[model samples]
Target chain A: MNRKISIRMSGLGGQGVVTAAHILGVATTLEGLVSTVNPFFGAEKRLAPAESYVRISSSQIDERGEVLYPNIIMIFHPHVITLGKCYTMPFFDGLQPEGILIINSEQPLDLSKEDLTKLGQLNARLFYLPATQIATQVAETELSTNIAMLGGLVGVTRLVSVEAIRESLAERFGGRKFLASATTAALDDVLKSKFAQVTQLVDRNMEVVHKASEAVQEYFIKKKEAGSLCMLR
Target chain B: MIEQKIVEPEYLFFQADREEVFITGSEALKEAIKRANVDMAISYPITPQSESMHLVGDLYVEGYVREYFRGENEFAVMSAVAGASMGGVRVFTATGGPGTLRAFEIFPAWAGARVPVVCAFMTRGVNSPLSIQPDTIEMAFMLHTGIVMFHAETAQDLYDMLLKAFVIAEKPDVHIPVGVFADGFFVTHTREKVKIDPAEIKLPPYNPYSSPVPVMDMENVPVRHMRDPFVMKSNFISYAAHASWQQEILAAAERARKHIHKYLGGLVETENEEAEILIIASGTAVSQSREAIALACQEGLNAGLVKIKSIRPFPEEEIRKLTQKAKAVIVPEFNRVGWLCKEIKSVVEDNTKVVGGPRVFGGMTMPPHLILAEIRRCSQ
Candidate 1:
């Protein structure tokens, strides 16, 4: 089996969506898996709707650009849903069957009945975490919110090993400068200043990942006999 | 520059050891230039192409490049690149879309002068309303510019084509500018695993003395001549001289076939050519076609693929032959004009068999599903 996994990360700009995709891609590559990462094409403006896509496979990956049929979708901010700050309308459009969706929120946002019914039909798995809260409480920086979101993804799907994530984090922050964009490089400077050294930055971000992984909670959406909406923990 | 052993082009391209690294197309270009032993690189900032030259500038800081600087604009930069190349040194530069049009006049001039300049065109849309997105419509204009053009399908192609372009363009029998174009953003911004050679070995330095045209180094030839510029004269001699020179440029590109084959394998690469349905494309569209072909195969539609690597010396005979037995031919493109489709249609015998598109322009990605839809429709 090819076992290819496609992930789409949607978030507001300055949320490290591109950086998170880069780290995940490197981790998958380190595990001897093939992966390709691409940021959404748009002007690099803060707070704008931003997205990044990653495709990981045990075999070679030929497809490129945005992941139109993503098996995994990561939402990094509540605004992506509540404020429609997403390129993909409904935020979960084109998600694969039995797909995993990890949203960065302490509680489930009020999803529409139509959207919920569609997700239920697809048998989608929904996971939520207070990712920004974990970043601030554990990593001591909101900039680490993207790392926290990755932790939630690992908690939900274990797509990559924690050790690989650690090494990838080191490679991104401790190794050479990785430029996702000019704004990203500037944000990295602000992040690096929060820690005493590169090692400290990696260690603190790892803590954010671990806490977010454990903090993540699944909200089960089941289609009742009457087609009524009910969420079960 | 860091000390690197000068190795034969064949040895470096084929026998040299390589390692796989996940990097963006821009980074891959930097890696290629590090081992190209280039003498100088001029840069002017433009979206998609800016990062590539920015990374190349980093090479200069790291001592991998001998000389690097920013130019006033695309035209000035291209002119500087030509001047540097005419001075008997390997030179590199990059521009795209608007920048490509901005520096348009210099491209043909480079070929007419036979400077052996290697330029990377990170192709994008050039419309009235500005767009910094991937589109190859600019390539249609460049086709008649008398320069050899190669379209890269991925970052790996960008790297390999760039390195090999230098050798191809500098051939004594076919000295001319070679444009290595990659779809902006699709290849430039996308990150994927690329195999690259070690940094300790580099291609041998260019020997300008072997150039078909006079090197402007002033070493053995007079520094200034042209007392009566040819363009100033409108007699038959001047007209004939210009006409023959243009023909020579065209001949130079034709002469490059054997060299391109020796390095790039062929102008076009075919897969399952015996199949009745064919998808012919270049650049990132070829990448999309691979996915669509795989999908089509799952549906039991046996479709073949023809990847056109060299656009200038187009695989005319190859395309015509490949499409001869096919019932349907599909050409997916990222540009609005469907220039590639027009080219294939012109060469293929059964013109109606060629489908102009399923094209997505203005930076929209061609969902493999769209191409798959075409395959399914073509089968019906």
Candidate 2:
């Protein structure tokens, strides 16, 4: 039986949260798994609160739009939570028990004791990575944070392979027409303008992806050695 | 004499085996039109519809499509589409929400003209408050149009129905326009596995000579192609002709059922034959209903689902047959108007057995739990 796994990624408008979700959807398909990504944004100009939902399954998926009761929640911007910029009052309101929450932060979340207790009660797993920092450092652009976040997604869940993500990245960013529609052409135009300075944009993003993935891998190993303890900030 | 030349769609997107691709509903619909070998696509960009048309616009360079452009507005695009179809080619366009209403007045004329032009309506909320979100309110308004309607549940259905829309709409006897619908982003923006017809097998060409009206190609075309023969005469003749023409459009849609059955499989799909409590729904609501049914079954309740794939011609017989033995029929919808329930109430007759609510408007999701609650209530 093919079961669907729901994911929600939240961030500001400029963080490519939508693009990250799309990349993950494509990566799932590359692994012969079916997936859908529907982005919901309220950006009037840019940097406004944005969210995208992605669902992946081995069988046919019936659900659409936002992924409520998500098993995986990736927040691209810390402001969505700290500044209360999410669509809902409680950003993590309906997370399933034993859910995974990945925060794109430079350091682990310095959560309140109440928040820590809640995660403990739910048996949730928390991971944080310096997604923006990694993107800026490795890919040399703030735009590549989505790529870094996608790498973190793969590393955390292992839902899609790193190789598949690499393939999807090339298909999307490597000057190749994946589906060859006008929308795709427009996306390419945007990318060519954005990534003009990067000599090999896809390659630079791949480096960021690997670095993020390795950090996630190391976090898991450290957690295992620390007596199943979820390290809080 | 009206030529009895029935159009058996020779150019089905696929005649041989299908080749699967992972894509969005927008792309799936576009691919179906591409495989159908559309001659001209006159589109006005609108939410839930622009992506499909924008992508179809790219097909012009691929040689799969001869002409594609963005018209000024829905009304202008619709008129251009009417002209293009009359000019003897397979024509296509799409609109949703306010766009659907903007082009609303042109549809009845298209029906009277008996053009087999196929349009896709990815449903959304109309204006005033101004929302670009998913809603089926506009579809309720369209229920009275003579156009043949097929509401799809998934990306795959969107692809299949669009190809079949051209086939069924062009049935010589059933030449009213076909509008295939799916909810906005729920279907349009969501990517899924949609198997397309093999590229090697192309759809047959659209033959304009078979049209019920004159082909406006400057050859053997009717001189007054815009005016109906009876409507061009006396006032009494015009009223009588218009009244009878409306009936003819309905009759043509009625005649299309068999073809819709043949090409797209069936109008309605029923699940759980022996269940006593039935849930009737359409589009993505059917998908939600399926989950609700499974959950109800897990709770040891006897529940089934009747998914109405064809909304126009309303699938009355199928709904009646499917719900005959059920103690209660739950009609859940994504709109506040309860149009699906209204259609069912008009048919099922037993007032107590029909449940209309758990409706979600303004793009709020009708989660499975909502339907599960309704199913539990109905089971009692």
Which one is best on DockQ? 1
TM-score for each of the candidates: 0.97, 0.90
Model 2 regions more than 4 Å off? A41-45, A110-117, A175-200, A217-233, B1-15, B221-238
Interface RMSD, all candidates in order, equals 1.0, 2.9
Interface DockQ per candidate: 0.76, 0.44
Per-residue lDDT tens digits for candidate 2, residues A179-214, read 433433454566557675434777778889889986
DockQ of 2: 0.44
* Model 1 clashing residue pairs (backbone): none
Which predicted model would earn the best lDDT?
A: 1
